[model samples]
Target: MSEGEYRVAVRALCDFTAREGDLDHRFTPAPSAREGIAGHALVAGRRGEGYEAELPLSGRFAGLVVGGRADGYDPAANRLEEVKTHRGDLSRMAANQRALHWAQVRVYGALLCAERGLEGVTLALVYLEITTGRETLLTERASAAELTAFFEAQCRRFLAWAGQEAEHRLRRDAALRELAFPHAAFRPGQRELAEGVYKAAATGRCLLSQAPTGIGKTLGTLFPMLAAMPRRGLDRLAFLTMKTPGRRLALDTLAV
Candidate 1:
């Protein structure tokens, strides 16, 4: 599983259900493991299937397999999801080592592709505990050739544990278990500002926002600004206020 081979069961469920020929979008855990992760993919929207999952290694190797599991997998969409229990906050991961976190899902994707003899696979890392009441999902793609190359490299480097994959998985797991939300719930109007900032950043548009006297304007402005700032090239982000009080307050908020 070269990099992130953690989602084998998802592919299996999709495979099994498809073989059943029911177009059974339902995901079911393989009668595979004794215990571990347990969730199913949403599958094909209304045609979705659900399932429980095991984390055991197939065709057996020497030691216990370190990481890999999918609570559920949706074949139609080629998506594999791993469920995590955490004090949810997606941005906390933005500063995380990207290669490592992405490796697991990419590897898992490779595994899924191998299982179904597929040419492509999609991986989703979902966190259910987010403050926004939304799951944090990260997606990636794996082509068969890519998966094969990755899996072969993983097998070669994995046992010796010389690659970034294992490290990436560990960091991701830790962040999920221990990382706190970088910012709390959006201020009363922060969500709107954040959305606007996100759109502006996404499309390279300019933005102008005003905060009257006392709302938490700094966060209201900066939170989304930070989130979208990276999406754009980030030449520089300036908060200019003519009023001493407003500028003082904005500068003070930046300390957070």
Candidate 2:
């Protein structure tokens, strides 16, 4: 592992690597966000006292940190489940969708097994139909080795991107930490505006500075923002402008 590493959630991993073809909303048939939360609660309530809901699980794969919450788990039964709430016929779901769901649970199974020091585990996908109030389950038993392999395969798919992201973040942080004011001296009002921006960024707040045009506003804003980026742990900086001329001026100042 390098000094800097990429962290990813299990859901993100499945969403990033397991997805295929165009995004199709028709086969999903998932419930609304609010309804989905309620559905999960209802299902958790129905389970036995041994049932664990919203179980947090995490594991490290290569240089990436993968973590997420499992919907339900039963230690005594050695079962880990991913609950999905839907509104329509699940049979209409795309093969890739089902594969993606299974991939997520399998990774969760691996995480649980590693965390609990188990040799094997059961992976289950519990689908609830909102309209019919029916539950359908698909279960698979996987040995620890199989689960680990599945987790590694998924991580391997994202390893290149994760590495690049980590490298970019490192370079950005290094540059930000060493950045200095561009010009020899700040304009009359530029110092105040730049100071406000730096303080706002450092404290994680918003800043609205009102200044007349052509007072070195662009360089003043950019200098302090770049200088504060490392301190604030910012991943990206966006300078939004209203006009094409403003964009050109901002870029031109940056070139200085």
Clashes of 2: 0
* Candidate RMSDs in order: 19.4, 3.0
Candidate 1 structure quality by residue, lDDT tens digits, 182-205: 575765776776677778877987
* Cα lDDT tens digits for candidate 2, 225-256: 88888787776789999999999998998888
The per-residue C-alpha lDDT of model 2 at residue 254 equals: 82
> Over 4 Å off in model 1, which ranges?
1-47, 50-68, 94-98, 130-132, 161-256
Q: What is the TM-score of each candidate against the true structure?
A: 0.38, 0.84
Clashing pairs in 2: none
- Cα shift from native, residue 20, model 2 (Å): 2.4
